[model samples]
Target: MIDEQDEFDEFSEAGEAEMDENKGLYEHVNITVDPKQEPLRIDKFLQNFRQNSSRNKISQTCRAGNVVVNGQIVKQNYRVKPGDQISLLLAHPPRLNVIVPQDIPVNIVYEDDDLVVVDKEPGMVVHPGFGNWDKTLVNALAFHFEKNGSKSDLDRVGLVHRIDKDTSGLLVIAKNEYALSFLAKQFFERKTRRLYWAFVWGNMKEDEGTITGHIGRHPKNRMQMHTYTDGSQGKHAVTHYKVLERFKYMTWVECKLETGRTHQIRAHFKHIGHTLFNDERYEGHTPLRGVNLPKYKQFIKNVFDILPRHALHAHTLGFIHPTTKQDLYFESSMPHDMADAVKKWRNYLEN
Candidate 1:
């Protein structure tokens, strides 16, 4: 049996190896049906072909449109025919290792018997997943919980929601089962208030706008999410954005998510042709808007270098307390890199 770590390392290599299908980020798996083979479900065939794969996992891959037959995505139950050339994008492996407590510091905004509020910094992943097993927020929480003398298990320590690895922000972790259940309910019902600040390309005609689309993992690139406008595919998602500041070419905007789908803000803005600045995964690393003069291009490239990651910050989060039943709100100041980039743009505008 392949260990989880080995599987993740292979998946990581595959992701960094090549990119195709309009710059998608996923590994390509190709196979051909045997001439003497009988009809079988695509998912079943994949299960047999991919070692250590469960039928449920293969079904999920098919549903996500990662399984294609003869260059077309096939349904989970699609019957494979002889001579069919099968090609698909394989999804990355998940983290399956046991969570071990690490003595890492966490910026705790507030902590009570029921919960703890944390200010997560950039470049720190929220949980352990493939490629990242330690130095996570969860690992830090485990240490904190141990110090507090709580006997909660590793998996149920207190994680109700999560922000992206590169997106810095405020997050709440439940300390007990009751608190976790209560907080989870609020998030599921969209009762919690979350706000993010992002610098995106292009100028908006309106000061504020709402983006509604279906969001799902990109069929060709599992690394990113794709927005579906027709509502025919993916989960329903909504993001309302308001312009906070307008630069000569870029716009700083505030985003409020109505549905917390993965990459809702980034993918939704990209759908409207306003990808976030320095968001390399979605092609925001280059200048999408603005003049193409050598000086201007150089300036943009310099800004990208200064701000190494996407210009997105989860600045505000608010929710009612589960035990105390009191309303709570938390906010985080913008990171220094983003602040410095904004300052550079301001200087350029002055000159």
Candidate 2:
């Protein structure tokens, strides 16, 4: 059954009206630098005012003529004078609802007037696609907007980016058109921070390293992806990983994405011979059998029975708020099954 947080009735219909007026709009903040302040950079000063706004956004605004220092547009690093009259024009974000909303239950972590951060569970598809038509996150968001009488247009509602159906983690959902556009831009420009935790087979030789490759659809298997060398139709993907812990036959790793790509972490690990544990497609039973150790064999069998899905979870996400421009970060612990597997594996090693 779908669970929901208590309704926040503090907002009346009038409040919604007020929010509409402010949505996708920016307010100006003028600050006078103190001489003792040592002349902070323009971008830094603006960031102080817009707490959640990304540095890239501030830079973009300044470069686009939206920000004027002493009535003149300047580069992001321009030092602010003590009495500089900094004027900033905030633009409303474009509408983001391209798909129809369904009543999907999203585990909302944080919410405000402009956006929402949801902890999406595994097996929940973000958007509608082939083989799955309904009960998606978009559908649930549509129901939410409808219930509030904020029937957003199909082309512009709440979605910013998406996580794969089997990958669970924090996802940002925009509440209005302007916030949606702003957040989308941040993700597109790779200004947001996303960290994931996963259990993979084998110990990594290095503590941390970056994987760079061009990823594209598999030539033989249309449903799968492969690292492309010719770079004909693929985009550049980069994944950075740090070894967090190690087991006799497995390693717990933390991964950060410099560029978001389809199956990025999974594919990259597979490329490096450290495919995620219980990943059916990449690291199958052959690798497990290769160990030829009875205890290890029993552990693999037990793990497979209990953990049927990929051993990956989005552990942390951080980004600048689109409206208030404040820095925000959220984290989720590994699920019970993953934790259990780790514990059991470690105990086996100790014994």
* Best by the lDDT measure: 1
Estimate, for each residue in 3-80, the C-alpha lDDT of model 1 and write its tens digit: 112111111222122111111112356787888879998888889888665565566557645566887878988999
For residues 51-110, what per-residue lDDT tens digits would candidate 2 score against the true structure? 777666676666545566776777778988766766665433323435655666778788
TM-score of each: 0.71, 0.69
Evaluated at residue 52, the lDDT of candidate 2 is: 70
**Stretches of model 2 off by over 4 angstroms after superposition:** 1-105, 147-155, 229-233, 285-287
Q: What TM-score would you give candidate 2 relative to the actual structure?
A: 0.69
Best by TM-score: 1
State the lDDT at 104 in candidate 1: 89
Q: In candidate 1, how many Å is residue 236 off?
A: 1.2
Superposition error at 98 for model 1 (Å): 3.4
- Specify the poorest-scoring 10-residue window by lDDT in model 2: 7-16
